[model samples]
Target chain A: MTQPTARSGDRFLAAQPRGTGVQSANLADLLERVLDKGIVIAGDIRVNLLDIELLTIKIRLLIASVDRAREMGIDWWEHDPSLSSGKRGLALENRRLRERIGELEAGRTGRRTQSPDADYEDDETPPARPRRTRSTP
Target chain B: MTTPDLTWLYAVARDVEDGALDGLTGVADEPLRTLTVTGLALVVGSVPRSGFDERALQRRLADLQWLEAAVRAHHRVIAELARTGRTLPLRFATLYRDDRGAAAFLRGAGPRLRAALERVADRAEWGVKAYLAGAAPAPADIAAPADRPGTAYLLRRRAQRDALAQRFDEAMAAAREIHAALAALADRAAEHPLQSAEASGRAEPMLLNGAYLVDRERVADFGAAATELGRRFSGVRLELTGPWPPYSFADIGPEVPETVDPAGTGTAETAEADVEADVEAEAGFGADAGPDAATGAAPRIKPPEPRSPEQPAAAEGG
Candidate 1:
């Protein structure tokens, strides 16, 4: 709204408008509005709010990108302890990036404006290369 | 010994009678207090002593289940008071040292709070959510297949995906228009466009989420309009929730933009550095229609204890 918005993360605050046991279409908008924007009132409670403070920030940071997070190793949210096959793939990509950096340093004499997407350079199944020409079988 | 050092916080509104909703209490019997400035009552509740420490509050707020429950609880009681008067809710977690504190905050926020109440006055908040349902549209649905080397194959697949996507986009646009039409019949639209893609990987990622402030008495007309629109659009999922407090129209506060890198470890927050996020651009959280853990339908919270400790509803988002 045009009014000064309430910055999130005040440990001790009050209630916002809430609905019934039903969420509507503008659920996202309302969620952001009710959750994000509001009247600003910084508080000073005698007791320190250290414990629950980080909880919101920690999980608040998790609000978006949890799907991509799944692709990585931090699967804590899912409660999965064992690493998934994707972890190995991610490791491979990291190795390739390291090697690509090594190559760029050697090739450009330590100066480079752009980097290539090197992880996908090797493709035993790549269909873009020219077909082989054989004389006779 | 002092009384837990607990302070009460509440939401108030312009035009709500001073004594309109005094005795309301939230879960755990937290007495609701009202702060008035320029004729608006700022309704609020207290923060228990235990949650006072920054460290403790941080830890608890991070717990999805805990945060969700707290927010849901706050919403419930505020909604109850909304029945008799015009109201604007405070941001979740607002606290004070005592009645004087509540009054001081309200008094200080006098102009801003009153304006907000005025904006949502005589209006109600309703939500509409749409999902792209085909087993969660595959990533390939968003991007062209990298393996399709030949121009024809790539072009064909690209065309197919584009057509489907166009249809989806058009349908979503239609839904927005539908919401607009219905809202015109009542109150104003709360904020900006909200895309639910941030909460992906679920069976439904809430394709379109919006909140509208409408007149309370015209709630039936609003629902009927939505119903007719629902009939008009067969393939899309259309649901309307609430005669809720004007959450969409009210001011909670500015958001701290939270960004997750997706690189295994990521975090979300709001910064004033022009950093924008899709979640911030939207409204509302949790399903208002779920089993009430206390009795009826409780708000949908991230499962505290996931069936598999490994998957602790880590998949959930704002």
Candidate 2:
């Protein structure tokens, strides 16, 4: 597939109508490629890992603050089941099993340190607040 | 005494023609220059030491406005150089004491640098990110029979949860399929960590964040494949970006260690002495006179033929 002999640069600009110039490119994409990936030649000026980490934290905070100001509940990853790992799935299953075991133990002992009803109430209430807040925005 | 200006390194290339970099400017709007040593050209510019010294750089990096401007300026230079020829873009803040320091560093890194340049020659990096479509609608709640309202309500809730889990599973499966299809068409593929909705500024969840190094000739084929995948997988949106300089595929060798200051005192004099000593030790040993000396001309590695088997089916299906 031989293309026209025009320079690859011109071809790039033509191919991407959205434009690959700095103004068109998003900051997150630029940061991910520029900072996180590339040739790492250690120059005289030393930018340690701590500095990069701090910059990343600052960017995240900046982005989060903007989201907060807009009142957009953009933390869908936390609630998205596909994005959540199998480990989280196992943790939820484990919690359910533990609750069942506690119920069984309470029935056998005919006494309870804390009522299962109280535990259920705790679980139901806290989760409800976040869900409500998310839906409002 | 005035401190000498530092050299801000943007990229490394082979055989840039005279006047190719004319009128090109880099970070801080400094005019770009090339320091060619042992056949590699270090595309650089001069920035004041007062602003780019280690202490000042640390402060500037923390300032989001300064970093954004600098990063954009740095990328603009690389993008312009890439227009002329194959360019290996350096990380954002690579600054040398002067041209001599940069040349010495290049001499030491010549062979590996040559290998990296060869690998990316006539190839462009393209990004493919996939996102889930607008929020999955909630499963309709079933009306409870009059007699056993509580049991019916619980059953309906369980059904809704199951439906959501199933949708999530299908979305993930579609993402894996999309990545596999795109990876087959490119010369090399890398999967970057997914960006969160907040970072991406999109309402939908990101499913795949990938970078593919495609032969310049096959960029069209690769892009077509991505568009096909987008259509094949309904409810999942695929975004194709770039023709980027090979930022994702430039890792060819171990990195040379940066000079570390054990003492909290980061004095410029000590750092200068250390860099000069490093340059002399490496350059004095004739490190640049190795077998890879002929890298002044571009190395011609055979380009892989564009893969065709599964692509035809995808194109037809779409």
Model 2 clash pairs?
Answer: none
DockQ of 1: 0.10
lDDT of 2 by residue, B192-275 (tens): 766644345444567777777788788767766766666666657766668688887776455442333457454323323333
Worst 10 residues of 1 chain B by lDDT: B290-299
What does candidate 1's lDDT look like per residue over B1-318, in tens digits? 236655645467655555655665663357766545446566666667676445566556545545544655666666765666677766556666555656656544454455556556666676655443322233243344577546545554555556565656656566556656765876565433333222222233344555567665666666667666665654355545566676545653333322234673423311121232213223332222211112211212221111222333764421
Give the Å error, residue B269, model 1. 30
- Candidate 1 is scored at a TM of 0.51
lDDT measured at residue B86 in model 2 versus the true structure, 0 to 100? 80
Structural similarity of chain A in candidate 1, as TM-score: 0.21
Candidates in order, interface RMSD in Å: 15.8, 10.1
Q: Lowest-scoring 10 consecutive residues by lDDT in candidate 2 chain B?
A: B277-286
Evaluated with DockQ, which candidate comes out highest? Answer: 2
Q: DockQ of each candidate's interface versus the true one?
A: 0.10, 0.15
